[model samples]
Target: MSREKLLEVQDLKQHFRTGKHSVVKAVDGITFDIYKGETFGLVGESGCGKSTTGRSIIRLYNATDGDVKFRGVSVHGKKSKDDLRIFNQKMQMIFQDPYASLNPRMTVMDIVAEGLDINNLAKTPKERQARVHELLETVGLSKEHANRYPHEFSGGQRQRIGIARALAVDPEFIIADEPISALDVSIQAQVVNLLKDLQDKHGYTYLFIAHDLSMVKYISDRIGVMYFGKMVEIAESDELYKNPLHPYTKSLLSAIPLPDPDYERTRRRVEYDPERDNDKSEEPVFREVKEGHWVLCTSKEFEQYKEDLVE
Candidate 1:
């Protein structure tokens, strides 16, 4: 709810009930602030609830508990239709599976123009067509491709169409939920670069969710690490990669493959042993290890980290 913050998520929780009354904690008490014009990356394993967190922020799924604030306004408490419409125009989402996100039957133009139609943003058919073409070109697609269906495009192209559709509404915030994961590895970079370019040009803020560490490092201004639906660590990109504090974070970073075979061979992998869970029971609570670097873990780890800092 700060003036400088574009989005503030406070202790967000999302739980799904199963048949036996068991609950899957998809997102559990995660909190973060995203400033305007910066990419805040959420990185974790596939089921760590990164995507669900993104969806919850955009109101795609209602949060079981907590608050999501946009520009000092609470999205969860908004009751006015005009306010909701303003929020919709300001926030947008790009889905993981491009093929499924886009309507297979709709023409590219219609797909891109759908937001404009729904929002009544354009006054005439010609204006809508122009807006669609502009969005297509912004995502590196041609205006001629507007008449084609989504199936006619490749995975990367389809993803571009998805980006265009999101862009059509002229949004200030975007939740890119694994935007390049489904595409070929070679094509992944292209999509990422395109997104970066668009962000740079428009000064857009993004909550980029991905399991790929290297890609997240490439696009994110800061990175947050999640484990079992909980955020364990968060820091600037370089700081997190170079000096991860949490045991889970260390383990996750250790798994990233190095390009040099010699380096890869010599690098020690951090093992996550359930037997070693005793570390969580001992002294410092979740405390700041350094400026802007936060770690949520056992008191012992915090004390040890603090000791290291003092030393």
Candidate 2:
């Protein structure tokens, strides 16, 4: 990973009005940065706002507060259509559900060429077709499948098509929201390998959102842990795995399936009590306990975390 910053999400929040006087804080005051050409993994259980964080960064959901900066430009709101177009061109998303994301009415070519069409990137029909064909090849598909609809392909192939669509405009960043979660166990590795190959070739920065901790560790240089709409820990992958600081993180690591049957049988799962773990009086802020490692904790908790690391 390079030292250059690509995307910065500062205290980002996404709140939804569910009723007359009630608001659901889907994401509350989360902060992290995606470095240039690095895959930053965001991991958490479902309903922890990992998907919301991805959507907010891509402007699918306008953040209710705080700012998301892409290469130092604000992405939240009130941008001109032209500016938004540029933002869309620069950053793209590969949604979790291939079935829901692809248009059954549209052919693979049309779906893949959607971004190009929106940005007016191609000059002619032939150019668009050529671009679509190229993108299909890029994602391990072929021109022969261009005329087919979404329903015709398998889950993995449909996801490849989604990857193709995200790459149509040569985007600098891609928000892959649980891209592999819907696929078979065998196919998951293939999709992830494809992403890694693409990143190596094109130097694409990724916000890889998933609940799969082991997969995240394999793909991401750095990982951030989220819980109940809050970012609890952020660190280099190996560092986080070897020395997880937060109670929630320890519990999460404990749950990861070990390779050995002996170890698995003997391993004890660390039970996390959210009410017991988090202090209500003073909200914790993310503090760096060591170089390149961050954890959210109150002042007293920070000292304890530091001491724990030392021990």
Candidate 3:
């Protein structure tokens, strides 16, 4: 593992056994590195294992195989209780669904203070209460709101509470799994901005998983595209948008709506014809298209990519 890397995920695979014979490969052999203080975006269609990857990285689900290293320590495999607890404190996850993630029975104070209490981060009740108030304020909520229940708040407020809960432990890395998806469109920007501001202020690393390409492009330093439980391409955000190489990536990029109606109507959509290309074969192959840019697919495409590079 590199010293600069905050979270190093190597060949991570998560499989679900579906009875006596069948299995669902939710995440298969995907590898990526998240450096400290950088937001690494994982974008894909729903049911493409974006959330699964996020969950697996945070140890919400034990990986079937592969290694997830936080700092220099391996988080997976057998470990002592103390070591695991330390790793848990260093990394935390913000779930996708704001409505279901929070406990309706618990007040906002209890919800945000739960992690701090579990980790023994505070010495006394007064100290914990103060910490909870500070966390709520950090996420743009007033201290008075802490007495209210989750049902009293709006979707965006609930999500902010979730963010505050994740931040309570002072985690170095966070898996933000579609943090703004459940909120109203008008409120989404506010949540995104809050996250960005938090990152800037606290120097937190994030694996921001979302299906929205534009949002991912806006928040991410680099992006990785996954399809059918496989990582098809990964590159710097600007380079990926400007020069997407994989057929799947091109198709995904084509789906993003343009601002002008006339240009939107005039622009041709890049259609991925599986029959015409036969690029979905079981055999996996990845080639380097440019510095720090990788594409996984067929040999012919790799050859064509090479020719294009030369030209």
Model 3 steric clash pairs? none
TM-score result, candidate 3: 0.94
What local distance difference test score does each model get?
0.89, 0.94, 0.89
Off by over 4 Å in 3: 1-3, 278-282, 307-311
Q: Candidate 2 lDDT, tens digit per residue, 171-244?
A: 99999999999999999999999999999999999999999899999999999999999999999999999889
Q: Which stretches of candidate 2 lie over 4 Å from their true place?
A: 279-282
Instruction: Report the C-alpha displacement of residue 160, candidate 2, in angstroms.
Output: 0.2
> What lDDT tens digits, residue by residue, belong to model 1 across residues 1-311?
54368999999999999868789999999888999999999998889999999999999889999999988888885478877888899999999999999999899999999889889999999999998988989899999999999999999999999999998889999999999999999999999999999998999899999999999999999999888888888999988887877777778889999889999989999986635743645542456888888888676677776665421
Better of 1 and 2 by lDDT: 2
Residue 18 displacement (Å), model 2:
1.5
TM-score of each: 0.94, 0.96, 0.94
What tens digits encode model 3's per-residue C-alpha lDDT throughout 221-251? 9999998788999999998998787778888
Candidate 3 yields a Cα-based lDDT of 0.89
TM-score: which is higher, 2 or 3? 2
